[model samples]
Target: MTYFVKYLPVTTGNSTRLYTDGRDYCADLYEDLRSAKKFVFLTGLHFMAEFGLIRTGKPSDAVATLAQVLRQTGERGVQVFLLVNQFWRDESEVITGGHPIRAKIMKAGELYGYLPETLKLFDSLKGLKNVHCRTDIHPNSDIFATHHQKTVVIDDRVAFLGGIDLTYLDGDRWDTSEHTARHRHVDRTQKFWHDVHLRLQGPAVEFVRDNFLQRWNHGSLHTIRKKSLNSYEAWSQHIGEDPRHVAVEATQDRRPPALPPFAQKSVLSYTYPADGEEPAAPTVQIVRSMPRKDNWHRQKPTWNTNRSDEWEHSCKEAYLIGIRSANKYIYLENQWVADEDIWAELAAAARRNKNNPDFRIILMVPYEGLFAAGLGSNQELFIGTEMEDVIKASRSPATFGMYALHQHDRRSNVQGQIYIHSKVLIIDDAWSLIGSANAGGISLEGVRSGRDEPDTELSAIIHDKAFASAFRSKVWSEHLGVPVGPTYDVHDADRFRGLANKPGGKLRFFPGYDNIKRGVPTWFPESLQESRDPLRIDFAKQSRIIPSLSRDLLASGLPPTLVRAAFTARVVPSVPPGWRCWYRWHCQLHYDPTEPSGRDPRRAPVYLKLRSLKYDRDEVWNYSDQDSVYIGKLSAERINAETTTAVLGVIRCRVKILPLDEGPNDPGPSMVLQFECMFLNDRFARGNHPDFVRR
Candidate 1:
């Protein structure tokens, strides 16, 4: 018989062998490792070196704890295996931007040499006699694709999984007490992040154990084998070479039932046919897509393409089934909300009143783009463009409102708008999904244009009501700014009644819905619409000319005052002949080549010239490679020097350019380009595009 185990706090009937906040969770993990004797397997998105625990002065408590556990386990002669995402290799950098508090931590770490030391710790563990730690990177995409599953198994008897990444922030909670308020960073007044984690025993432990082992074996530098006591000549003299050997303490006689490595284990010892098993063990499948094939985890054997249907079946499909299965409400919190299909489904569900008409669908997303204020160009432009399209397409004209959450600082009046870093889904208080995958084609379909095929993403479909209810409640509480309590019923009749009577209803517009409905502008100043005729001159030329003027102004002087003035001026440039023609033909182009170009030439290059007309535009807009306006595409063969010189001279003599708009709302010098593309009949038809009409 196969058994299913679900661990969630406040869920009915679910086991609670492990329960703790972030601090206790880490402490307990350390305790579990210290007591383990046989084997240890660990995997996480990040495992930083010793650093003080958040809100506490215990220096590098998490790291120190893990190191102690490793040392103790090694002393007992246990074989320990660890796998962490290679993305963590660069400890000095922040994974996502927008948080000044985190930025300060990163800066301090750099100053204190924390990054190098962290790398050294991993190196030391890898060099240990009995410990093996490996880092893996996925091939599907760069930082965008990561091995985000967090799991740990000790002696193949205990395991954990959830949204918790191995980091200090995940473990810290607000003190709530006034005594700790004086500590600038340790204020207990604010709530710590809210999340869920599960601990499992029985056969499920083996599944997690195997996952870590597979990742370790696949990514480790050294080869390892399961040492059977009977096969070891030295151990044979001691225990007659039994497959199960005592590395330190004697083996316990209380063995639960033994099954093949791949076989599922349950309370009752029942063997199914090698090729067949009924009601597949309530197994939580582990899936990951990495950049490097040799990172750490052993890759599963490729499915035989001979059976195409079977191969397709084995591949994880997008969460269409989960979305469709939602009965009461759909609660979502994700890093980004740009997937059109997902938004469509939500709208359909809301309109159909699939659950009670009062049914609620709440989405928690970062108020601003994560990449808005960082090293990379503002990715928000592209994401915002997509978001706008989705919202526009899904708006019920009935009743539906999307709200955003942001973090705020009461002291300085600075709000750190809530950045929806968590990827979670709760459906009708029945199912919950927590994983690394985002809401995009690369995550959902797995297929990226230039790649061979879409790979697998890991996610667990939890059916435990306790887990779902708890998750939904916490998510809703945070989104609605309510205390964590069971005050609202997701399926309450009054809720549905209230939603249906609204202007559009719960599926229709709320007061502030317009703000969420509109996508981030492709161009700044709202008044300056996108122009396909690059030469089209406008009075507010601020958006069109400021980006160029800002660049020139920056190069002109290094003085802080001058730089400030230049940025504030919002001075842009008049469209050059070529730029004007390109924009007219393509709709959008980057004004600066050095700036981040949201468009991939392979995917969209038509708006390359728009780069020259930069403003507070979204980053995603770009021209396609097939666009006729692209200068690179036009010049298949380079023109001779004589032809270039003649063309340059004629253009220089014909047009005299000047700066455009300079105003307060000019959005400063660091302008981004945003583009919009219209597709008709399954194909991108440029002539009929709405953006072109404005030009």
Candidate 2:
């Protein structure tokens, strides 16, 4: 059996570098294109004409129109192969009441012609030599599947791979990972684009090049409508019929050319261009998910290679193996995640290492997507929910945590949205992959019902610890402002958990945008204290096992039971102020081996009950936490008024401590709730508010 359906052996003696974000990445690519002597292979899901270069924060950032640069490159005799997915958003298999809408989209696809209306900015480069273009349906994939790989190989010596798009006339993706609002830079608007891309040099480049040729040999040629072309490009141009332009009539009833036989043979090395230099890299492996099929209806699977009737889908295989082999940690960043098989693999990994409390998984996904109604967004949300449930239901819920990147406006430190669109996975800082394969059913065998095939995907994997460690630190520096260190250094799990619970810090944890609106806690880490925890109340999960005698007794004559015998509404008992009411509670527990009731090793219970004056809601003894029980200077003003679905009046709440279990027929007595400090009274003012679902 063939081990690699479409994988090449690890390419050695190659150097690789990482680009932190979109700004400099885009700029640097433009510069590389300018210096290319032989060929530039570019492929993506979509295209944007005006989507050109940006002004990176660096002094060397170049400012140029990407289309113009491409034209000049072609004029300079550099081969440019540009392949994009079918120029239309796919239709759903099951149609409902929205027939007209689907029909309109299909019409739009046709009206846009072959290359573009297709895309708003793709028509301007119709006439250039050594510059070729095509629209692909990923011949072997489901008709609904897209050619979703993003790669740029320059002269076969260097390659760029990641989850970035070039479909903007305006430079919306120019900021660093810092992601701040801009005044007037590349375009009139500024967009927060948090993405990752890689620069690969060496044998892996050969494999990436093969992937491109396989598609080009089997893809379709696109012809644009003459009318739309003329309308959009009426410059100092020709007055009559244009040979370079083809109308729908000229292209009507046309069939894509059949693929020539080139068996699934892959090239691990190629002749360097006349002016080429050796690709420098220590080692890298090329892995991709491509189905080997007879696109031309030939009797054999491929022409050039002996291997036939076999397919290559090494991306999913690599991902599963990486996750299963992960002993310490697994870090993942993708636009969307919806693969059940991958989730199962992760769950199994967590179960195996029950002894290692630090063995964990961390994920970063976009807060939300632009295509909320699309299948991608729907599946992503579904998977995220299921993943959280699986972790919470497991023996140890703290084994997994997910986060989202947040970028406050550059000028004013106000919270803003930052989109995470990189498809990457790193395991134990020993193995990593960077490319266009997301953990989605669509990406992994699209329409798992088998009615449709998976989307075409590509990724490069490396087993170099030095490279992986360096890459991890580079990413951490961008996201957490951590200093670039020599070894692969990530935040300690304990320290990370501690920092999350604190209030403010430069690299504070962020709950995914969806979770935050749903009233979830941010950075549930019980330590660091937000860089401003003046009174360091330990919030670490380990803090639960502290001594229990701290709550023994007080010299003052106060109530001994957990609940206050009687409580008042306001500071003054005589005056019931309708505005705000405060409830304060405190506790520090200690256990003695000498005592009978406090001998249990587990944590004690801190219970809470909430009620409204209008009898709108009521709850008794809700478990808030175990170790220590406390409610700050909690008051009516602190909670959001209009946002919550509860009753429309001041809320009344209570705190209770359950009796500790002791010897037979002897339960330890409960104690009164204490107030140590006052919680600052302020209104909750987040932009989006979701109704809290009562469990």
Candidate 3:
């Protein structure tokens, strides 16, 4: 299998360096596009026309940056195409419950008025004839599975890619000074956010350009010229190749790097575009994936069979190639760090001889979970537990370490806390991939997100020694807790010495008891088994009395509907499936090495019984308790005494109730009673139970 890679060069000695703040980058990009003579193709997840250039101010009066770009290029007879994720306006209506009935009616009227206004904006770009703008929607999933890849390719000679979007949010800056709420809300406060982006000029530009063309032409909606076509002009001129573009000599073709215990591929050389009108750069390959069909607007579907496999292959190949070839160290930054397989490989590499220690891997991730809020009950806990498992599985406890950097406030002398937004990997000193692809299956396989196409992403390989050396140095400085300056060197002993000298600066190990300077503690000083087990709880006893208590509340003049809804929703303190599994596993694994008896057999059944009960209960309690409450509240105030009695009778028939079962010896009954009481109390508090409220 052929793996694609490219080299990007950073312009040295220029303060015009790229920074993470979106506004600065956007301004620079806009200038670049305005000056372009050749082809211009741009793609991003979302691009609302409302937000414009500039930070902390009314959007620049540049009413038609995009439209102007099209017209100018068209007037120049240049081929200009723009591709955006086909966001279904109606889908939002369905997801958000039709966006408030009032808003829907108002929006319909506005659309009628806005259509003519939008047409006027379209007419302003009359000079540019060869322009086409369209939206590409993926079929596999909803609007959330968007074409997130952001790139701007001009004449296949220069390209830009990173988390920077074309929308308004992309232009905000970090602000450290305290400002009044009104001032901050009015966009006067200099609130900056951390982010990263790359400009590619070498062979990589071709890959990005190709990706944009493919997405634009394959989109569901195709824009046509309002008038007859005049002469067409090419967008860009082929300036000669940059002198720095080196020829890659073929080495003995090694087996494509494999998941470790197998040899890995090393980075040989990288090609990047040189800054300036200095000749064009070497060839860079660009690879992208998205849903096969454009579901953004209603259109015919485009199918690609190998897209999933190809997307997964890209990330795996990149890692394998980089890891095998890495001789010194690897640096990575991502929004999340939870990939078990890759962590395993790093652990293996770290376990090698202490002298060589394979390669040092450094990762920077966000301080808090990105999608933790959306996860159902216990999902966040499961993810956290799994991440720890990955860390422990590593060969050496110290093999991996994570950190977050806060951008400093120049005025307050207080550094803004670091928020990692860039997903980057730099292996050895030779290979680097910077793009929007997170370390997850959805980004890799395009499967879970209902995406028919792979994630729209862009990354370029960098080969320049100076660029790699500088970039790697910056990352290392952050990892080693060194100030960013010329004093640090990865190969120098002083670098390690400086780290050792800092207060509480000793190297920390994974799964081992140690104190860290920043971030939460991962390992405990003593065995974790001795501490209380949060998962341990009885389900059977809880199940028994819960139904009885719920029925009692209903019989006592509580709305039956409310009681039923609360019971079905299961929100009133009950063992969720994951909690049960965890509890069981903890008991089974909670072995005391000090005990003379080998692993306890009694502890083994704990997990088994838990699993069985969960499976069975799932059948009994699958309905929504919330729904029940909603319905019961609307019913007659008088309690349906007969129905309540029937509910209690059914509970008694289904569950074996015993007084002793309420104690520690029988955890199930106790849990059932606790759930039952809480359910009734909640109903009474809500005035859903007339008897309790009246009494």
Candidate 4:
């Protein structure tokens, strides 16, 4: 499989450097900031100006902070913009339906606040004409969703995007890749901080620049009582004023900032231009998950005809495409894996390669203790149990493995698992994706049931073989306590699995089942689960085209007969009877994982049973011959595929056939429909599929 996908755009002449952990990223970021000649734009979910960037060689005053660096840079006439997520309001100020704890904390002592360092930073930066600091709220108005993207663009020449945040509280995010534990105090102690950040040096930096300027200049439309939310004001003002005294919400309108002279071109224009060929240089593309609203930015749309106000879920589309394209192996590491859609795709891939002895699906996440610290829900246990059932029912139960990282201090008999905060996905040692989004519904498929907005996210799809393979080896070597060489080649899946089970390595099987018996604690209340790690999603399975299928056909001005002739001729060869497949129309579709059968015609799940196919010669369609056609018998009793009628018209538009490795000679279809993420449950979704269903 190739690293680049034809539908997605790719930018050439870009250089990339990877940081496996936060310590190295901070060092490089500090030096880069010190060398800045033009301007700097930085944003993150949590931005702490007090975060140390360098060791000053004194025990009492041991390091220089990010605030110091920003001060020094501003003194040199460098324009600086800092945009950070704003979730907490001062005790005296509050917005409508904002921050659940605000009312309670105010009633207690009238001194409620979070992240005092942010306020300190704002006060310190006062009167610095070259530096600007602002707090941004997610446009969706969903109190739970946040602006979670961590991106930095330096001088419009280099950019960094990944999961590493610029704050440290109970856990220091500045820990080395080794995950060493050197002290017991919160300030001095270093917990394992495993993350991935990419530094890009080339024209691709414009994408990062565009994203920042859009968020930075978006005027605040939210209101507190009658007053508009402040975006260009001091944080300390909120602390001084009383929420009860504020009257008539005043409007705060902001104009879009001027773009750099060199950034007049759009990133979409840099796509592969030559037909039937690609550029000789490595490439990169930026993808984002912006909400349906907030289209006030000055940047152009990704598509020429599409409006900027339309919802953009490019990050989700990238993940689904990457997972389905893997041939040899798929490696995933993230803080959480609660997204059922992602799990469904992974299970389908495992089923396809169950009989291939060399195929492997490896995953790494935080160990039990650390996992529980973030949230109370054991989502991994629930999803992991279903996945095990899927693989166990298959012939190759060992094809899928889940492990976590652990480090032991023999001297003090203190041992704990290294927190796996990185969000990364690598496929076949050829392509990779790294960014701030976790493998969960909140990060990927945003805006659950009652929520109004999705968490804003940014990720880059990279197709450079050298960078992908070398970074994969570096991460694997750290987990297995061995170097990547003859014994541990990048393509050697068997060796990687063998080393994961051996002692002395940091990797250990995630004890999901055991944690069930002992019980995982819910540090937060049950009501907050949806807010912390949202699980509800209502996305359509086949809705990710560059342009809507119906619009494309209509805009072409082609007659119905010619349109059907063009698409119907693109079908794959027939598989055996009883093989599961997806039967979908070209219209808009919706699937709700929570309630699949509840009377909504649009939300009804669709699946089919392959009956037979009569080929017309080969790969060609002669409409005159009725016998030369493909047919799918609707016989699934569980999903009521035969009885449940959809309100929308259904045409025999497309069918994705999954060829179970029934015998040693059978190779699967070249292209797959990949609409199975909308399956209702385990029985119909995984076990009832072609490979694992009992005959």
lDDT, candidate 4, at 77: 88
Query: Which digits, one per residue and each the tens of the lDDT, describe model 1 over residues 238-309?
Result: 333332122211121222222224443342332221222222222233333333243222344221112222
- TM-score of decoy 4: 0.63
Tens-digit lDDT string for candidate 3 (1-695): 11232232222221113344455566666677777776677776555443344334455545435555456556776666666554332222322222222122223212211222223334555545466545454553241244668778776567788766654232222221221122111231122334567776654454565455444544444232222222331111111232111111111212211111212213233333333322222223343444444332222112212323323235444554455455566566775444444555555545442355433556555432232111111111112323344345443434445444433344544332344556677665555666766554334445332223556565554433445556666655544555555332344323432343132332222111112222333322233235333234333411211111222334546443323322221211233322221111100121122332212223322110111122322222221111111113321222232121111101111221223213222343222222111112233223322112222
Note the Cα lDDT for every prediction shown: 0.37, 0.49, 0.39, 0.54
Q: Which residue runs of candidate 2 sit more than 4 Å off their true CA positions? A: 1-8, 56-63, 89-121, 138-144, 169-171, 183-191, 226-282, 291-311, 369-376, 388-397, 410-415, 484-490, 493-695
My TM-score estimates for the predictions, one after another, are 0.54, 0.61, 0.51, 0.63
lDDT of 4 by residue, 1-695 (tens): 33443444678888899998777888889889989999999888765667776544456223357888888888898888877665433322432312222332222212223334455565566678778766666654332356879999998889999988877643567767666654222232234557889999986787788788667656241212223446433343452364332322222325434434543555456564344453466778777776655453343344322343355566766677668777677888887765656777887887777766767777788764222333212334235344554455333544676777777666655566677888889887767889887777456655344222456788888876777788778888777775775222435554544554244566655554222212222122233334421112111221111100122222444321111111221221122333433333332233332444323335564433222233322222211222112212122233333222111112233433343323312432323222111112223322211111211
Q: Is candidate 2 or candidate 3 better by TM-score?
A: 2
- Compare candidates 2 and 4 on lDDT and give the better one: 4
Q: What local lDDT score does residue 594 receive in model 3, on the 0 to 100 scale?
A: 39
Q: What is the lDDT of residue 561 in candidate 1?
A: 15
Error of 1 at 414 (Å): 7.5
Estimate, for each residue in 1-695, the C-alpha lDDT of model 2 and write its tens digit.
11122323555677787776676778778889999998888888766565547553454333366677787788898878787776332222111112222222233222122233243334556667567666665553322356778899898788988777665322244457666654213232233666778888876676777677767755554544434435533332232344322332123213533322334543433222121222244446666655434553332222223243245556777678678778787888776765666777777877776677667676766544322212211222234335654464334645666655545563654453455677888877777888888775556555423323456778877767877787777776666555656354334432344344243433333332223123334333334324332123232211111111112221223221112111222111111112121222222222222332222224342223333222223322232222232222122322222122111111122322222322213322222332211111121101100000000
lDDT of 4: 0.54
Worst 10 residues of 4 by lDDT: 539-548
Residue 499 in model 4: shift from native, Å? 5.3
Rank order (by lDDT, best first): 4, 2, 3, 1
Those runs of model 1 whose alpha carbons end farther than 4 Å from true positions after fitting are: 1-24, 51-55, 58-65, 87-118, 124-127, 141-144, 168-196, 219-298, 301-318, 354-356, 372-399, 409-415, 441-447, 450-457, 484-695
TM-score for predicted model 3 compared with the true structure: 0.51
